[model samples]
Structure formats: C-alpha cells, structure tokens
Target: MARTGFDIVRSTNNRGGVDDFIPFEATMRAARAAGLPVGDYIDEVMNGTPGATQSTIDRLRALGVFAANPNTVLEIGPGSGRYLEKTLKECDPGRYEIYETAAPWADYLVDTFKVVAQPTSECSLAPTPDGSVDLVHAHKVFNTVTFLSASRYFFEMARVTRPGGRIVFDVMTETCLDAATMHAWATKGGPGHDSYPAAMPRQACVDLFETLGCSLEAGFQAPMGFASTEVLVFGKGS
Candidate 1:
C-alpha cells in the first residue's frame, strides 16, 4: 500500500528509534556474554537511580493509585521490562500482561516475566477483558502515533481499565517537537508544526483524558532523546 505523508513520517521515526536500540541490545548481549545476570544488566541500563518505574510508582502512590492494591497490571510496551519488574514487586498484582509490538521484545518479556505478551496495534486490549485491569500503562508508546490515533488509544485504555483504576502513559511534548529534526519532520508536506500533529500538547492530553472520565493527578517531564517527554498520571472515575 502507498504510504501517506504521516505514515512515512511515523515509519521513519520508528525506524530511527529501532536503529538507536542497537547500542542497548549490544550492551545487553555483552553483559550476558560476560555472565552478568540479565536483571542486573537491565538495572544498570534503566535504573541506576529513580528510574521510570520508581518515578511512576511514586507519582501513582501520591495519586492514590494503590488505594486498593492493584490486582491486575498491564503495560503496553514493557520496554526492557525495567518498569515491569518494579510494578510486579511493588504492586504485587495477581495477574500481569504486556502488549509489545516488537517480536524480540515480546519473546523476551514472555520468557522473563511469564506474562501474557501479544502483538498490539491501535493500542487495543482485546486480549484482556474490558474493565478488568487495575493498572493499564504505556511508556513512550503514544509519541509514535498520530494525534487522532492517540485519542483512540486513550479510549481503548479507558475501556479496558476498570472504573476507579489508573492509566499511565508518556508522550513527546511540544518541547520535544521543538527540536530541529522533529520540527522539520512535523512540518513536512504541511504548514507550521504549531498544531503539534507529531506530538501531544500537555493541556490537550489532559483535557482528552478528562473527557474520557479520568482525573489528572500529576504531570511531569522526563528525559527522552534530546528533548524532555511528558508523563501523565490519571485516575479513572467510578
């Protein structure tokens, strides 16, 4: 199928992310070859200090995300499984699932965590029963999708997460899009990137989540490439 401009841009950006993974993968391979535990290797790479998982947990705890002790936890990417390990240890979920688009990562997640892992598209959670999971999350996943797709993904996240549950996700923000590369890519075949078609605006994402019956708890910036990414934590309404 002929790709549209948006498709081309998204494909190219995704390839760039994948290409950048070479170093991370090579480091892991070398660590394993040297007889280092994979978990320790992952920790060295992802969690030297307050990493994404701990940061998320701290925010969620502040937001009362664990008022009832989450029983089911689902992560969209489970990237390196750093957050997955922390979530399992801290949340003590009864059931765990992960949706990973990359086959190698999916296999690694399944093998390591014994979690139900599947290929996902459109951020769908059909493999999980609706309104069942206590926590549905994705890290650095929404940034790659278009604005409209992000909204749809949010709807799916709301649908699968139980009432009063919590959903967490991160996105590239206006700051990230302001970079020359991102700005140029977003402006390709169109006007200015002020509309932020390639990234979500902070207020816009908050409003959308609010309309989806989620109440914003906290929003913060974390590192992503050359720009800072935004992390949003929301509590679903009953």
Candidate 2:
C-alpha cells in the first residue's frame, strides 16, 4: 500500500507516541474545504499568522530576489510548497527542483506544481550538480534543525549554486531574541524539541558565504512560528 501523508507525518513525529502533525492530512482537507491552498492553510490557519507568507514574499520582492530572473530553481525542504507557489509566480523557473524529506509531501508538490523531485538526503545535496541551480532556498527550515545540520546544508547550498545565483535561507538569530520574544519562547515553547530554533551568528554566516565566493546581497527579518528568523540572501560571484 502506498504511504499516506498522515503515515509519513506519523513516522517522523512519533516522539513519545504524541504526533502533533497527524493532522496534516486533515489540514489539507480543511484547506480544500476553505478553498485555500495547503500552503495558505499552513500559514494563515495552522500557523495562526495570517499574511505572514506574503509578507516574506513582499520582502523578497523588495530585496530584488525575483528581479534576478532565475531560470533554474532548487528548494530544500519545501514541505507544502507555500513559498514555492509564490516563487513560481515571480520567476517561473523552467526547472524547479526540490529535495523534500517527506515523501508524501514531495509527491504532492510534484503532482500539484510539476516540479522535479530529486533523491532526498539528510545533510547533502549530492544529487544536484555543482553550480547548476540559479536560485536555492529554504524557509522555516534552519530554525528547526541543529547548528551542524544547518551548517552542512549551508555549505551544500553554496556548492550547488551557480555563479551569479542566489542562496536564501533563514535562521533564528540574536535579532529574534529580543527580551520579550526570548521570554515568550522560553515560557511558551514548553519542553521544546532538542534541536529547534537554531541560532547562527549573522557575521559567521556572512563570512562563510564570502569564502564560498558569494557576497551578501540582502538580509532581512521574517516571521517564524512564534518569533522571527533572519533571512540572508547571498549572491555567488560570476
């Protein structure tokens, strides 16, 4: 039998037999019922942050992410393809490749948006060739992983992006740790997942990408679960 989305969700989120993500299938149902896309439902209803997705897209617009006119796009872990949906409207890359861990979600995105799904891995982009993608990005991803996991992905991101391409991703940084936000995260987060809400210094990220032959083009703040993450855009030198 083919694995259902709920099965996939359960498999990954079965810690202590409490899977908060089993509702993923139901969430898609609700999204259809409300005439909203799955991505919209994840942002506006499930995340309880109406318009947050568009807000980040707007910031991307301001930062000239779309204006670069990329033709080949690669996304890391585009769970519901929320940002990918809008990104298609912005650039309509001819080849939209994705590496998503959730099999059901990857199938959904491939069937729904006609994207190319590559073999998935934990910390490597080995299936994608070096300097092949014009734009590579991950959203709401780094925040939930460990420092080393995020760093490994960062290195791969830079390696696969072509010169003049852009690599975009977000991380929970000191900027998101204002006193109130920190208190809320500490108090409300409630027995948090061990690797969550990873923090990487902004300077370190800038320097790492610089050595990889990319220069910081733009950086900005974007909303995450209950706080914020810093989105960094690095342009590879031509």
Candidate 3:
C-alpha cells in the first residue's frame, strides 16, 4: 500500500530521518526566515497574540462564518488546540469535532479541549454525517494537500454541512508563495516543496464549492501584516 501524505510526514520526521514535511513550527520558521516578520504579523492581526487561533477566528468572522453561530462546527487539523480554544470561547458551537492525523497533537487537543477525536483516513477528511454540522472550518490544511485531496475534503465538508450553513477555510494564495520562502523550505527539505500533488488555483477552489451546491459568498486575501493569505467562505444553497 502507498503511504499517505501524513504518513510520509510523520515517518520522515521520526528515527533520524529527513524533515521534508511542513509541520506548523517549520512553516512558521520558514516564514520568519523569509523576512516576513511573522511575530509582528501575528501581533497586529491577531490582537498581539502568539498563535494563529485568534487570527483564524477574526478571519472567519470577517468572512461571516459566525453569522449562524452557536451551531456545531468541525475543524480539520486543529494544531495545539488554539483554534479549538478560541472556537469554544467565541463561536460557542454546541459540539466541536476536530479531525487530526498528527497523533501527538491530536492527543493534546483531545486532552486540552475535552472533545471527541474522529478517525480520519489518510489524506482525507473523516466522514462527517450529511447535513449534520452547521459550519466546517480548516486552516492551512489544504496547502499541504494535493488538489484531488482538497476536492475530496471540500466535498466531505459540503456533505456534512447543513443547508444554509457555511464552510470557512484558508490557504496560501499563489501570490503568497514567495520564492525566498520556498528556497528556505527547500534548504530545510520541508514538504512545502514535496511531491504530494499539485495545488489548485483560487478560482478552481471557488468553482468546486459552487458545483457542490454551495454559493461562494466571500473570498479574499487575509492581511497578516507583512504577508497576505487566502480566505474563502461558502454558504450551502437551499
């Protein structure tokens, strides 16, 4: 059997192997090394906070993700439970389901947030019940995945979301992919340049949602001080 992207990432980092995978820390370091001023970016956009949780929350709100809040929300790849914490405190979802393939991080999140851990297939989002969740959110998860994997995840997100609910997520726009950053990542042998699969364009992402019976309400670059990121919000059509 072929190894999944998560498997390759985990295996490469273990047992004195190469770290060609794009973990959260390495990505942050690469961004900083590329002279993006990640700290200042986080502070200014995330209210001077140290993590991407608040920044994600603010971005979600800016995309009108919470317009139908107090509903169940599913977040894929909730690293360190920062987004989970913010959502619990702010979004107040009736139930928060997190899907993570990283075992250690998943364990930490489960312990810290006291939420259920749904089993996820390799390179795929877990099977969320149809029309069960009010909102689905993912942060930077799609950047590491292939276009096909992203399409599958988006379809799953649409399947789980209730009619009139929304899906909010972010990615590294083509403009955001700096050559200097890529060089650093290359030097580090990070997965940012791995052969997982090709990435889809921003317009293709919008088209995927629209074809799945969702309306793209908003899509734009999220300002993170020195760098710009892509954010998209989709509402399920009735």
Query: Which one wins on lDDT?
Result: 2
Q: Give the C-alpha miss distance for residue 103 in model 1, angstroms.
A: 1.3
Over 1-238, each residue of candidate 1 has an lDDT whose tens digit, in order, gives 2222121111112221223222334445656875755544544454343244566667667767666779988887665676777667666787888876655556777887888875476556777788898998887667655566667778888888889888888887765556585755545523432333356787787887888888888777765433456788888899
Per-candidate clashes come to: 0, 0, 1
Q: In candidate 2, residue 10 scores what lDDT?
A: 36
Candidate maximizing TM-score: 2
| Candidate RMSDs in order | 7.7, 3.6, 7.9
Candidate 3 local lDDT, residue 20: 32
Q: Give the range of the ten consecutive residues with the poorest summed lDDT in model 1.
A: 5-14
lDDT of 2 by residue, 1-238 (tens): 1245333343332122122322456667789988988888888887888788888888988888889689999998787889999899888788999987666777888999999988756678998999999999999877766677778889999999999899999888787888999888777774636445567788989999999999998888887768889989899999
Instruction: For model 1, give the RMSD to the true fold.
Output: 7.7
For each candidate, what TM-score against the reference? 0.72, 0.89, 0.70
Ranking of models by TM-score: 2, 1, 3
| Off by more than 4 A, model 2 | 1-23, 190-192
lDDT of 3 at 161: 86
